[model samples]
Target: MQQTVPPPLRPYIIHPYLRRTHTMIKKRIEDDILIVTLENGRDNSITAEFYHELKDIIQEANSKPSPKGIIFTGEGRFFSSGFNLSMFLSFKTPREIADFFSKTEEPVLLDLFMCSKPVIAALNGHTVAGGLILAMACDYRLATPNPKAKYGMSEIKIGLPLAIAQGEIVRFGVADDRNYRDLVYFGKMMDVNEARENRMVDEVVEESELIPRAKQLVSLWIDNPGRAFTPIKRLLRGPLADRIQKGIDELDWEDSLKCFFYDDVRKTLEFVQASLNK
Candidate 1:
């Protein structure tokens, strides 16, 4: 006999805020889990603006009376193609980049680590670089079995070190130091099987089943019903989180770092894109 998988539950209402921002990142409650959808037709880049909105939404989720969980997923086909290269190239100074990242993103990462709520990631498609880091922050990651789905800490491929905070999260998420090094250092995109084998993802299911499985997984935490889940998670994750936070505080001129300067990355990416187009 074979098993059947359930379909994803579509949120009744998808709210969009702040028309100024190109991306429409929104949060809604489904049962006990807060579903935060990263929806911008533009590759779902994580700009400082996105983090500001995320902080506001997460704070709201925390304020709710019921036990809480989070489900992070992309709006369309792409989970995220990673940082928007065009955005990366627009930085005028490293200090600006550093300041933007440290001030906006660090707090969000800390919030995810410290939040009493359990988070589940629905990897609907390819997840790259910082995007993958966002998914890894969650307590559970459910990926699609599609061969096209790739996930990795690919910052090194563009001459940047993965953010200290992101690296630390991946480290703790995988639970094995060696596998973490291979995945982070190689900066290579891994298929679903490779991701599952390396412990980058908790489980892989059909694309249509990703969200429901995520909800089911979070339900277990909601059912367990206590601080034990988040408490133990934070406890085990405390040291690494502290280390990353300290590193972020110490970073200088991070925004201006040539590693992510658009020109170089663009040139490199053009060849890759051309090859893919071939």
Candidate 2:
């Protein structure tokens, strides 16, 4: 008997925050799994709108039980390059830039980090900066074996310190002290082998195997009896999630503003924007 695939839950995602006619996330269900793919610009840079839609999807997934699990991937060569460099340029002043970042920090990543349905990241390519945060939020991450793919957080290079959610998630994801320092302090963009060795991702698979492998892992997690995974994960991650949100609520953004407008940092941001064009 042929199984009928469920129609897409959100063919054209719309939300009040997004004033435009389009959304960057593409959603569909296959084999009862919610597959969310980032179809943003060339590098799949994270944007305010992208975060909003992703949060809405997570909320919808948690508010029901039909999809069973979720897999987040990218459309093309890059899984996500993290924050779009040009976004910073869009703001005219340090305060404006800081405010924008603050408004976007409604703990979208934390929502993913605490998703009720098991989540997996099928990283199609480069996963850096905020991209790393998104991957780290998932229960498991499988990076594609693409030569052009790179991973890790390079925010420090441009003098951006980890915000509340970014820092806590990185801390929660890894237990080794040395590894944590290497990630936040050095902030290098690592290749696939180095990424694996440094534990940026759970495993590396070929392009064809990436989505399939994510689905397989999600099945293993969701197949357990009695839906026990949710509470168990909560038991493990709840306190940290609580702490992160509390921090967000109290965040003032002044320090981050300083980092954003530091002369050297502004120069570096320009360099990043230039690099994207090249």
**Candidates' lDDT values, in order?**
0.69, 0.77
Question: What TM-score would candidate 2 get against the native?
Answer: 0.87
RMSD of each: 8.3, 5.7
Please give, for residues 155-254, the per-residue lDDT of candidate 2 as tens digits: 8888788888788887767646688899888887788878777667889888899989999988887777767777777788888988887887687776
| Top lDDT model | 2
Q: Put down candidate 1 lDDT per residue, 113-176, tens digits, no spaces.
A: 5565677889988888878888888778898888977888877776666666667788888859
What shift in Å separates residue 64 of candidate 1 from its native position after superposition?
3.0
When summed lDDT is taken over every stretch of 10 residues in candidate 1, the lowest stretch is 6-15
- Name the lDDT value of residue 122 in candidate 2: 93
**lDDT at residue 268 of model 1 (Cα atoms):** 76
Pairs in clash, predicted candidate 1: 89-262, 94-255, 94-256, 97-255, 98-255
Error of 2 at 168 (Å): 1.3
Which pairs, if any, clash in model 2? none
Count of clashing residue pairs in every prediction: 5, 0
Q: Which stretches of candidate 2 lie over 4 Å from their true place?
A: 1-21, 93-99
- State the number of backbone clashes in model 2: 0
